[model samples]
Structure formats: C-alpha cells, structure tokens
Target chain A: MKTDPESHQRMTQRRQEGHVKKQAAATVEKGLLIVHTGNGKGKSTAAFGMAVRMLGHDQRIGVVQFIKGALHTSERDFLGSHAQCDFVTMGDGYTWNTQNREADIATARKGWDEARRMIESGEYRMVILDELNTVLKYEYLPLDEVLAVLQAREPMVHVVITGRHAPDALIDAADLVTEMRLVKHPYREQGVKAQRGVEF
Target chain B: MKTDPESHQRMTQRRQEGHVKKQAAATVEKGLLIVHTGNGKGKSTAAFGMAVRMLGHDQRIGVVQFIKGALHTSERDFLGSHAQCDFVTMGDGYTWNTQNREADIATARKGWDEARRMIESGEYRMVILDELNTVLKYEYLPLDEVLAVLQAREPMVHVVITGRHAPDALIDAADLVTEMRLVKHPYREQGVKAQRGVEF
Candidate 1:
C-alpha cells in the first residue's frame, strides 16, 4: 500500500537478504528421527513421498508395513518393484479382526524384526517403519527395545515411523513429529467408499 | 481383557464382520477435490506422494507450483522427468521475498492459466496446484474466479490444492481436507537445516 514503489521494493529486498543469510548459516548435518501420528490420513503417504525423493536421489531405502497387512496398495506395487527400495508388508490384517491381541502381537513382532534389520543394515539411507506406532500403542513390540535400535542405528540413517497413538516417549525422541489432523473425511461423513489410487 | 479366549475371539470377529459389511456397502464413485493445509511440513510432500500413486497406477498427472517459484527440489527433478508427469514451476519465490505484490501477482496469473488448462484438458488424471492457497490467501487471485474454474472442470479430474490458510469455501468444496498440524519441527526448534531427500 505504499505510494512510493521504490521504498516498498527496497524494504522487501532487505527482508529477503536477511532470509538468505539465515539459510546460509545452517551447517549441521545429523540423521533425523521422524514421526507421523494422528487420526487423519497421509501419515504413511508422506513417508512414501520421502521414499520417492530418496529413490530419486539414488539412495537405497527400506519400507516395513506393520498394520496395513497384505492388502495390495499402489505404493507397495511401485516401491516394492523399484531397484532401490526394499518394501515388505508384514501382517495378516488390521488388529481388529479377532486377532486383536495375541495374533496381532505375533505379527508385529515379525514386522519389527524385519524393520530392525533394515535400520541397522548401513546399506539404507532411510528406513520407513510404517504403522509402527499402532504396534507400539498396543504394546505389541517393546517400545524401549525399538527405540534403542533406532538410536544406535547407522550414523546417517533416517527413520520414519507412522501410525496413530504414538507414545509420549517416542514423540520426545523424535526430531520431527507431524500430526495429520483430520478436518473432514468423506467416508466418515458421507459413507463414501475408499476409491482406488486415492485411498490405496 | 477377557479370560475366556473363545468368547473374546468371537466378539472381535463379529465386530470385524460388521466393519466388512459397511465397507462393502459403499458404491459411489466420483473424482475428488482434495485440499491439504495447515502449518505442518508434509502438505506438499503428501500431494507428491499421491502423484507417485497416480504414477504407479500409470495415470498421467499435471503439477503446477504456485508460490514455490523456481527452487530446484529433488521432487521436481524426479517428477518432471517422469514420462507420465507434466510439471511446471511458476513464481519468483516465497511471498516474503522482494517480488511480493505486483511481480508475484503477474506470476500467479500465468500459473493459474496453466492449472486451468490441466484441469479442463482431462488428459491428466490428477492435477496438483501446489501452494495455491498462499496466493489465494494473499488475494492475488479472486477467490470466486478460482472456484468457478474448479467447479466447471472435468468431472473425473482429481485436483489437489495445498498450502496454509485455506479458505473456508474451498474446504467445503473439497472431497477430502486434511490439516497437517505441526506438532514439532526441528528447523524451528533446533535451527536444523533442511536436509537432502527429506525436506527438499
């Protein structure tokens, strides 16, 4: 709203210079512990996006699915076949299908074993433990043991854990934590079916 | 916790059956209008993840970046070169940067033109208008005009708009609206630089 256009431009230009300077000042590099948890969607999707970025960068990545089970998803089909990715789905189904406690715990244990291998392998730059938080929530896998493995993994290995009900302890350990808050879901509101490509 | 194992298993099985029944009942099909907003880090990344899904399904996609400008990201390098994607970056830089008002408005206009083309063309199964919310929040483009164009586009085209401060009207129009809530960010708390293959 400044009548003097030159003065307005100068003010904006100065702010940009300050930003550039700040950007240049950051030099520390450390592998991040990232967590995605909440009631909304896109937690695992965002992790998959990072996997794509890693693959694009020519870095090998590992993906382990805990609660999603063997339901074929487009992401699994694509990433599993990619040369740079080692994708594994390790569950019979969701936890609510009578196998809630015992059977689910056994499945989660197997999944964690595979995930731990990928995290410590040193061959991978990133390891995605998809739906691991849900397993942790049910105490299917020992949270302390899982955290120890993550903390002691390869120096530059980034780990992404996603699922609802992330424990307070895990949040404290994470470098970046995003909660995908659900504003509106068609399935809940209008009984809309989970469509292909969008949902899977 | 039920001590009678058979009873507990039967109860859970019944619940799962009910869930399966509900899942099978939904039969509607329609193109989605999705909005990803909030102050969190994964808004754009999730949309890119959907782009990967669309790509995995072998469906062509169109991506038009609004306020991001010409930053060279790993995603751009990946998706731009992919045969199934048509990617275009339009704008100078972030809103706070020098070319704030006048210069930025002109850039937004051209970008909208490209987005409109993709939406109406029907060739692209999905079209992502990245950061269009920020431009709309700044009033660079008339809200009514953008809504009208979105409303009249191809019925089967999935359009995704992402950024912070999404307008209420747009939220009402979208089939899926997710707010990526920022629970924790390392860059803000620890001054950590945006690392390769994660932030970019």
Candidate 2:
C-alpha cells in the first residue's frame, strides 16, 4: 500500500492530537464542602442529593436537622433505613410553631449532643445540619460552641450547615459558601400552602 | 372578644383540629435515596445537591471519585480548600481515556486505597464516588475487592456511586437504588460536547 505524504502527515497529526487529549483528562482529587443558602425551597432537597450520592458511592453519611422537630420529613422515612446513614432531628419544630424557648432549647440540646459525637468521633464522611441557621438565628446554641465543634471536627470530615441568616463567623469559616436567594416562590401567593413531596 | 356558648364549642373544635394536625406531622420522617445514572449528564450535579443538604445540617462529608484523574472539578476545588471536608480522587483519567490497562489499574488502586482508608476509618458521614460504576463495568478493578471494601466499610458511612451500568451486586447491596434513565438528552441531536462546569 502506497501512503500519500499529505495523508501520512494528517494521520501523524491526528495521533498527536489524541495523545494530547488523553493527557488533558487528568484525574482530580475529589473533595467537597458545599453551602446551600437562599430563601428558597429545595436547599434540603439538594443536600439529600449529596447524601444519596455518597451512599451510592459506599461512603458513610450522618444527618442532623436543627430546629426541625416535626419528624414528618421524607428524608427520615427513607434515608433512615440505610445502615450507612444516620438521621437525627431537633424536636423544636419551629419558633412560630412551638412558641416556647425552653422546649426549643431542649430540642437543640438533644441534637447537639449527637452532632458533637459524630463530629468528634471521625466516624462519617459527611455530616449535614439542616436548618442550622435557625439555631444560630435564634441563639438557641452558642456561636462559640458551634465554632469549636466545627474547628475541632475530624480532618477527614466534611461539614455543612444550612439555614437563612448565615452568621459571619460561620460564613468566614466556610471553604465554600453559596447564597440561595429566593427568586420566586409559590408561598408568596395567597391561599397557597406548602405542599407535601416538595416542602416537608 | 365576647365569649358565646356556640362560639366556645367552635373554638374548642379548632384547637382540637390543630392538635391532631400537629400529631400527624410528628408521625412522619423525611428521607430519600437519589441515584445518578445515565448516558447523558448531571449525575454528579444531582449528587452534589445531596452533599450540600447534609452539609447545611453541619454534616461532615468525605468524597472520592474513581477513574477521574483531574483535581480541577469545581466541587473538588471548593471542597479541598475547606477544612471541614475531605476530598480524594483517582488522579488518573478513566481507562478508556488512559488507554493503558496498567495505568488504569494503578489509578483505580490509588483512589480505592484512599476510599478504603476513609471507609474503614469511619471518618466521614457521607462519601461520593463519581464514575465508580464505570470502573466496575470496565473491570479495571476486581468486583470482589470492591464488594469487600463496601461490605467492610463503616456502618454509618453513606456511600454514593455514580456512572453508567451499575452492577447487580452493588444494586443488591444498596439500601436504596435509583437508576437515572435517559429519556432524552441534549447531546444526541445537537452533537454538543461535554463542557466543563456543565458536564464536569
């Protein structure tokens, strides 16, 4: 077979291009610290996605929902069954719903106790604090204490805290911070209520 | 507010209604298992959402992406910089991209080695293994080895594996499994390439 000079040059060029392309797809070290901020629905939804992601990958995940005492969430019903995942919720519901400082404090204490253990034990790959900003916003938990827990957490642990009104200290300490501004919400409309499978 | 006998009964009825509502809410637990699968896009995007959710609750996360060599994904870049999170990747592109069986095996070994440490150490609450199914599908790593690692991993770790062609063993072992079926994709019609930020 006679090879044309131009064709031969083109083939060599293509091979070199392939080599470069392979080199370009260099593997990356995958670690993540993500923040879900915004006055919008689905922050928890997004967080659950990560939990399931880790679980699918055979990673351990721990979850604690602060100021969420209702216990009537889809996450609890589903994720709790997984041996790899542990889900806990503060039993304070909401200030608007509870309307009691003592009760909220008790709930916070219960959750805090568990959260502190996981953070210190270095037993999980991911830990989630759903609606933690509410605890900070309400001052139910001391900022310094929370900061200590975060700073002293195991080196391999990835921590995430969510809620409206993210404190300056928490934001400052965060490696990645995102603000999820409420663009538009169905709640703004009159006679509309939080629907199941979407809100709760 | 003058009290009337008939009005009093109505008020009492409303209070009872509220109590019942609260009780019903308390009986439920929110939970989910999201699986990122498909030949198209955004499996990791969905998984990242879960990580953020756990993080918002102040959950610590450990992440590992198998068969991915580059340390430049947005999630890794942000998470690696964060002290609260632990991130690790294969640092060697996929076997197809590498085109060298030995190199691919070494890459698999490197990522899995780190993952085994985190899983066994019980250091993370959640771990994400991006494109792990592909590795298993390609047989770059042994099935028994991966299964053993998963079986022996921490009880509390929530592991997530993302990619095409999840194995039966993995599916059987998973507490919750979701198959991200591709109903339609943007790439087929337009021939649009996988772009960073969107696909990576």
Candidate 3:
C-alpha cells in the first residue's frame, strides 16, 4: 500500500500551493486601526514613517494633528509639500505650553471636525490622528465622540492614532497597538533641551 | 558703549529664545527624499519603519509593491493589519519567475496605472514602490515612464523605490539616495533558501 514517489511529489506541490493561497486570503481584507503609545519621543515620528510609506504607494491619506497647533515641525514642513497627503493642524497650539484650557478644547474640536469629515467621507484610504492622547489628556475632546467617529468611519478606511496615554476604549477598539517604553530622558534628568531633527 | 548687567541678561535670554525658534524653523523647512536601495534585505523593512513613523505622526501614507504580486509576505501581512495605511500590490508575482512577457508588461502597466492614479490624485504624503528596480531591469516598464511618474507626482510627495539596480534617472531625481550593495547573501553564497519572516 505504499504511495508512488512521483505521486507523493505531486501531492506535496499541491499542498504547498494551497497553503500559499490560504495565506493570501488572510491578508486581502481591507481597513485597519493602528495606535502608537508610550512615554517616548518617537511616537509621532513612527506615525510619519507610515504616512510616507502610504504616499509612495499612491494611496489617499489624510492627517489631523491634534493638540499641535504650532505647525512648525519638520514633518509638517516636509509633508506640506506632498500633493497626495492632506496635512491639517490645529491652529491653537499646545496645552501645557499654552496653558489655556478653553483654547485647547476649541483647537481640538476644530481638528476633530476635519478628521471627522475625512473619516466619514471615505475620500481617503487612511486617516492619521496625531497626538490624540494630548487632546484626551486635557479632556479637550470627549472620549465618546472620538470613539463614535472612529466607529463610524468607512469599513475600508484605516485610522492611525498616536500619543501618550491612549485611552482604554481606544486601545480596546484598535486592531493593533504598540507601546514605546521610555527608560530614560534627558529632559527628566539633566534638563537638556530637545535637539532639532531628532525631536521634531 | 558699555551695557549694564541687567540689559546683558535680557539680551542673552532673547537670543536663546530666538535660537530655539530658528531651530524649529530650520527643521520645518528641511526637505527629505529617503532612498533604501540595496542588494541586501530590509530595504522594504526599513521603508516600513518609515511608514510606521509617518503614520504615528498622523501623516497620510500610500504603498505600492511593484514586482511582488503575491500577498503572503510577512511585511505585507503586518502592514495589512494597520488601519491607518493604504496598500496596493502589482500582483504580478516575481518577474524572473513569471513566464509570459506580454502578461508581465500588462501587469506592469496595471501597476503603473494605479501608481499614477495615486500620484496625480495628490492623496498621499509618501509612496513606497517596492521591487520597482526589477521591473526597470527587465525593461517591462520603460525608464522614462517611471521618471515621468516621479516628476509629475507632487513635489512634496516623498517617493521611495525599493529593489536592486536603481536607475540613474531615479537617483538623479532623488533628494537622498542609498545603494545597498550585497556583501554576502545567504542564497548565492551560503546556498540557504529564502526563509519566511526573514526573506519574505
């Protein structure tokens, strides 16, 4: 009852092909939610990497920079020139530095509105919500509203959220999550100022 | 004229603040074109790192896998799950492996079609064209077409073309170009076959 060598080889090849097909099916689905969280400086930097990656692939991408009203960073400066990417920044500025709660909330809402439009319209394949944690931290934007918008986004639209202290609800809803733990910081110790290009 | 100590102190503080502002401005204006070209592996891996970075910052990203038609690679597997990114593959499999020349050109044309749509639409901040060199090397896709696509794309769109044998035109248009020369490969030198998670 032994199988022929030639027949066995044919069966093996068929099995291999089947496996490859199965793997392909697993990845062909659309849309995703990715979050980057931690006490490190590169959270936004990491998100920017994905933005550029998408641009190269020629997919529609929309960006909403929350709590960062200044619009004076390297990412903004360079990405502003990209035709495919839509860069939107809250004109109000930072909360800790600005020390204006009302102003922060107003700015957050403005950015959130634009983000909501992009997410709902399905005009963009991917939407990035940067420094969202800061908006959540200051309670400038409601958590429920954020969740609702994310939930309402087109089924195939991917969303990225970045910042420290990601809300538990956001984390629960996210398809993938990455947390960057900070072991040491120059600011916390010797009070060294953040360097350009590296920090921004 | 001799200045008083108080005035000197005030001037120093102002100068320091001005320096910080200048640094921020410089970072904002600094343009970049990052190329990860090489014979060694990880060009796409490094490019993916950039993708994640941009995504974290809420930058819009697009990805185009040129010669790779199969969807089972680990890189695609990981990124496929990201909700904040959009990805498109040429789906021609490998050029060297595919037997039909006309079919290969048609596949390349389809990929270039999609890539052009993404570029002209101005919807992405960065676009990653994977294994494009292999297409250029085979001449299935004309070098001028690639150049025109890059040139016509938004000036701000940061383009990254991966795979081996990058053309001189691409390198010339690129703001920053890197050549990954293979010192030693496991396949040709060690006779080790491609491994999942490592090669794919």
Candidate 4:
C-alpha cells in the first residue's frame, strides 16, 4: 500500500499561518539595553557569545572591562584581534585585591568613560559593558549618572551589561533582562578548579 | 616626593599566595553533566559558546539537536563547517508543527540513537544535547534510559543539555545547572521580533 505525502501539507500550512501571525505582531525595531545578571556563571560568556553573533553579521562591537584584571582571557585575545571589534581592558583587578576604594572608583570611572564614548560614537552596533553591574553595585559610579548615560545613548546602539547583583534601577530600564540563577556550581561544592577555556 | 611602588608589591604578593592556595585545593578531574534551563534566552547559545571555547582548546564536539527543526540557523551553518565539529539535525520541526505524537516520538528515538552513539564513541570531548529536555519533558523518550546513557558516557566527556522544563532527576544528577530566569523579554513587552544572528 502506498502512503500519501499530502497528509503533512496541512500541518505545514497551519504552522506557516501561526508563524506569520506571530511575525506580524512583532513590529518594533530599535537598539536594546540587555542585562545579564545573578550569581550563576555564563553571564559574561553569554555576552561575548552575543559579540560573536554580531561579528557573524559583520557588525562592529566595542567592549569595556570593569573589574576583571589584565588576565589574558582567550576571548579577549580572539575577539580583540577581529577587525570589527575594539576591546579595552581597564581595571587593575578585582576590588578585594586592590583594597583601595578610591583607586577602584577611579578605574571604574575611566572604564565608564570609554563605555560612554562607545555608546555615543555611533561606530559600533553593539557595545558590551562587562562587569559594569559590579561597579554599580559597589556605588563606584553614581547610579543616576550611569542610567542617564545609558538612556541617552544612540537609539540604534545595543548595550549589554553583565555581572552579579544588578541594580534594580538598571533592571527597570533594560529592554531585556536575564538572571542566570545558580542552581549548582562545582567550584563551591565539588572543589573542581576552573578549567582553562571553560572558565576563562 | 616620589611614592614607593613597594606597597603595591606586597598586595600583589598576598593575592598570588591566595590564588595559589585556591588552585591547589581543586584536584578532581572528570566528566560533567551541565544543564541550562528556564524561560529566558541564551540556553542553547551558551552551549554553542562552550563549543567555541572547546574548539579553541583543539577539542572535538558533537551536537545532537532534538527539537530544533532544520531551520538554517547561522550557528549550525558556522559550527557545522568547522573541521573539529560534528553536527546533526534530527528533528523535522517542533512538536506543535508536527502535530503527531507518534511521529515526534519516532524522530526523538532516532535522535537519541545518534546521541547514544556520540556518547559511547569516545571521540568527542564535548557533546551538546540541544533541546533534549523538551523531549524528556514530553515523555517522548524514557527518562531512565536517557539518564543511564548520560551517566555511562566516557569519564572525561562533558555533556551539555539545553532546554526548558528539565526533569528534577536530571537536575539532581547534574554537576552544574544554570537557570536563565526571564526578568524581562522584549518580545513579550515591546513586540520586538527575534532578529537573525541574535536569536538563531
């Protein structure tokens, strides 16, 4: 007995109709303020993944590192070398190691300055403010000033802010916010070290 | 009136000592069951990002996509072309589109066969089971069999599972679990569509 292939056509047609309706409902187009926060891993990693996606589209990107020191991360080395990416590593190290509030604040301000320039330059389609939430959480930079700068950026420039402990105000202002909740972490529980490439 | 640089040297020395102690404490080396779940985005994207990092380390990766259709995703096209990557797209489409429980179950079983092969082949250091949780959630495949396959894989192989509605048993067995909570989604709030390179 021969089976009819046309039986699947109706299913495909219904799916197409649903998809078209959904697509038509989505009409807004503009740059977005995206936030990745909470205590889980993959916040910065996901942001860098976004950078890769943008790079695939041949779009320019700018990165400003806040609290992560000058540790040689493979992502920075790889993505930085890309012609469309402008990478900046600004902080000396984590605040605990520095132990100087004034110095940490100074470093954060400098990084913010660079981020502000990138957001306003109209050169990059996406700008990543890596660990900016940590700085904001620590109050190194005034919350209102940071928010104002973020709000006033070019309408078509996508901004990604990543770190744990994102400020409530930032969450309120973001177009997209993902909280990477820590369901489990090996470093804390199993004492497994952060492996190269996997952690860096 | 020149300041002494010796003070900063002491700080660096202390930090180095602390880091050495922490690094020395972590000695376990084995395979890991990593899960990415919840409502927000970046679950599968983060897994692909892990693939990129593993590639940077000259590692081989095998991807088994269960629920994602043969939709020409940029990630599949780009990663599948890599010399060190093996990619497979086994599903026709999402279950809603297929609208046939028996057909979906057959497709899932076929995908699971491929996944079991990859896990047992010992050729891949990292294997990604994209959207497998959805299949398990729908009971298309027996959860016990899936868990057994995952548990019995090569000792050094890292398996990453991505999707929503992951079973509690899987979560309990996982070494690491990250739940991407939806603080806010633009598609729901602003009616912004998923753009190419960003969503796919």
Best by TM-score: 1
Supply the DockQ value of model 4: 0.34
Backbone clashes in candidate 3 total: 50
The 0-to-1 C-alpha lDDT of every candidate, in the order given, reads 0.83, 0.61, 0.64, 0.82
The DockQ-based CAPRI class assigned to model 1 is medium
Candidate 4's residue-wise lDDT over A1-200, tens digit each?
11233554456568878887887888776788999999987788778777777887889999998977422377777678999999999888776577666687799999999999999899989999999998888788998999998899888788999988999999999989999999987644567867654566
TM-score of each: 0.92, 0.46, 0.48, 0.88
Cα shift from native, residue B44, model 1 (Å): 0.8
Instruction: Kindly indicate the candidate among 1 and 3 with the higher DockQ.
Output: 1
Error of 1 at A60 (Å): 1.3
Who is ahead in DockQ, 3 or 4?
4
True contacts kept of each: 0.60, 0.05, 0.01, 0.48
lDDT of 4 at A33: 90
Model 2: CAPRI class: incorrect
Q: Lowest-lDDT window of 10 residues in candidate 3 chain A?
A: A183-192
Supply candidate 3's per-residue lDDT for B45. 53
lDDT of 2 by residue, A68-185 (tens): 6322355676568889999887665555455555566678878888888877888888888888777777777888998888887776677766676778787767655655433223
lDDT of 3 by residue, B1-200 (tens): 12354554465467657665654544332223445455544456546656655665666777888767432355575566677667888755654344456676788788888877777777777777777777777677888977887777676566767667777776666655555333223222223333222223
Please give the TM-score that candidate 2 achieves against the real structure: 0.46
What's the lDDT for candidate 3?
Answer: 0.64
Worst 10-residue stretch by lDDT in candidate 1 chain B?
B1-10
